[model samples]
Target: MMGQLYSVGRNIEAKVMKFVSKALIVSLMGASLLAGAAHAATTDKKIALSNNYAGNSWRQAMLKSFESVGKKAVADKVVAKVDVFTTADRAVPTQAAQIQNLILQRYNAIVLNASSPSALNGAVRQACSAGIIVVSFDSIVTEPCAWRITVDYNAMGRQQVAELARLQPKGGNLLEIRGLAGTSTDAKIHGGITEGLKNYPQFKVVRSVTGDWDQTTAQKNISAVLPSLPPIVGVVSQGGDGYGAAQAFAAARKPRPTIMLGNRQDELAWWQQQKQDGYRTWSASISPGISSFAFWVAQQILDGKPVPKDITIPYLAFTQENFEAELKAIPKGGVASKDYTQAGAIAIITKK
Candidate 1:
């Protein structure tokens, strides 16, 4: 009887041991699955970007270029994602709000082309604190970001003014049309022009106003100044506004100003017009295309490549000597033809 009872006890103990071992195995497998999921989550990343405005041609070009090139580069990659936002008009606060929302969503990175530098300071600070890598382009933000990609605005400005001064060696009045209000690039370019003007004391900036970098706005502004215009020997305006200013001069039936300082595209067209009509108002200009360089900068950082704290791409100044050559060689618009929002996704998916 004692032996039988002992056998029964041993059988019960064996069953209990088997149950405990199976539970342990199940628990281990569950934990392993959870760990794998966490690992997968860590491998992929999110990027967010915002532009202050897309109202003008230049801004549109920028949007298109970034989307096109970035998409092509990352079509094969699987671990990356990009989110983009834009303020249709140059709305500073709206852009800031967009950045704040992106931070709340816990995006991994942000690219900012602020309409106004100082306006986005608070949002930029918040994003940096959240460990998001911030890349600034075109118009730089006031606060320090991870990287800034821009042209030499001041130099470009100075060069434009200097070119105009050369065109009017006798020291004529310079009618200056400015860019968007409160933008760093505007300040830099205008500042450079001021610096350049300092070199030529004879050149007087008789009238200056903000064209707001809009064609219609510039046309209106320039038209207002037309009554006092025949004295204006040269017109210095932002690229977009240059053609408008010229129109104002043309409408008055005055000899086109001796020299016009503006953007590359307008300068080329003006130079060609000058050749045909013997119009003297069109002179030299400096190229300040912001979109292509912006993409190049974003690509560098995304690829884990080192970039300068602030990268300044060289500008092309179109003068009579090389005007035709430069115009012919002007590279077709970079990535401006494609969809930009979808392009951001490609940036991350690229293997290298």
Candidate 2:
């Protein structure tokens, strides 16, 4: 009787162990399926860039960064295809039509560097309604449907003045070099610069010129105005205009002033030369590489990730003490930049 009862108990134990093993296997399979869902393949997605303008070195660099990442994404089979299209002009109508065409092309996503903050809302909404993801960076749009990637440009402008106050403790007249006309970026930075003046009363902006964020244009405009302006002690410029401002000051035979610089290769090269002369200044600007970051954001969104609507990146800043390394990091003709990968994008999204 004891032997029969023991044998029956052993059989029951064996059956319980087999059942647990099957349950364990089932649980693991479910977990694996969840993980797979989280990283849904983006291999079939098509993405395109809709750039507002390509006239300046900054925009050119922005496009180059986008292409560098985009091509690699294609080659690695991370995305099916990536394309770029630049509007001939910075007209809202032109870009709107361009986006409408992209929509008709059946692209899964559209990356935009918009011309206006609000004017592009109609087009952006149309894209969203068509189930196309619109990711706008740098010159971003104001539409709720679009994902925005940018730096605190207003803070950058304010910081420029703060840096000026540090380098030139005894402030004097300032020549303001502005950016492209009728854009939100120009207005935000300008507003910050104006607000900064209130904090540092010693600096006075006696002259202002629209540099149009182009070196040649900046030089011409600054030269045109230099003859009539007073003895300026500094030039507060939007990026891409600093090196030009320096040239204008030299060409006009005026005394050199402390000029805040952008992170262009030429700007850093000139800064390096000026550093030898004990010319102390700082450089800061939004990285053109934000294009690549934007690409990843768009991709992650398509991957079914929950990304924030507005993402702000830190500005690329350079100073007299620590700019040479970054200057060398950038290719001779390129801007200082950093690209993003899928992992990098995931890290950012996870944190958010």
Candidate 3:
């Protein structure tokens, strides 16, 4: 009986030792797992950015916004490296080549500021085929690319016309300084303006000319229109051309028109100059903060968050009510920064 008791005691002790060992092993594993997670939280992620137009202030601001946000994303362990490519002016072909280079480098992801919608399709396809996640900002690629970050350019145009209608109840003559001919923003903005004017049969589009995003060309167009017998009441122009219009107005010695639809960066400066000049007729603007919008889209791409294939940011319309405070807050270039944080990379659809 004593021997049986000894055997039973040994079996119980063995069971206790096994349980203690298993528990200790589990506790150590849990501790190691927590440490690994902490390390991951601080890890950096790398990204590549390619821009089509660096000459324009909007494009410059867009690039700056991307770099700043990308740095923040890395510090937060969202991303590490950022490879940037910039092409002079609006050169689509050069931009496509840059995309190929980024793909060759095997970047984790790519962000593009496309010039023409259809021109960059091949490059975008190549990037996706190479397994690099793609994001387009400011302008949509003509072909179906991953995601597009933009503002409601259509609404901007519509709003410009609506404001003009309010100012000139009796319809007046209008002139347009169009941006690059093939861009969707140009098309949408013009289309919206067309539709908005249909409401008033008296409002007529006297001339529509291509500025090619050139200020000189815009000034020339405005100069030509200034000599026309019918006095001009309003002008709707693409970015980088507002100052040119102002110059034309000054040269012509005509009171600044009743309405001027200026770009985002030029708004505050333009408004201040108008005020200083004591020009009350100089008012109305639609500003789409493209740089800040681009950063927001990049963050959405990084975190596995789902978003529409195409997204449009809201455009702000400046009026007398808010122009003063708005101008005061606006930066020199009217560029704004966006913040990025770690989130799951959204599963973007890539078609080859």
lDDT tens per residue, model 1, 160-231 = 777776667888787888887766767877898889999999888888878876667887888887787548
Q: What is the lDDT of residue 153 in candidate 3?
A: 73
Preferred candidate (TM-score higher): 1 or 2: 2
The CA root-mean-square deviation of candidate 3, after full C-alpha superposition on the true structure, stands at: 12.2
Q: lDDT by residue for model 2 over 161-209, one digit each (tens)?
A: 9999999889899989899888777888899899988999999999899
Clash counts for the predictions, in order: 4, 0, 12
Candidate 1: worst-modelled 10 consecutive residues by lDDT: 333-342
For residues 201-299, write the lDDT of model 3, one tens digit per residue: 778888777765566787787788777736777777655566677778779998677545454446456666667756433233323235434544554
Task: Name the candidate, 1 or 3, with the larger TM-score value.
Answer: 3
Whole-model lDDT, model 3 = 0.62
lDDT of each: 0.62, 0.83, 0.62
Could you list the CA RMSD of all candidates, in the order they appear?
15.6, 10.2, 12.2
What C-alpha lDDT, on a 0 to 100 scale, does residue 66 get in candidate 3?
Answer: 64
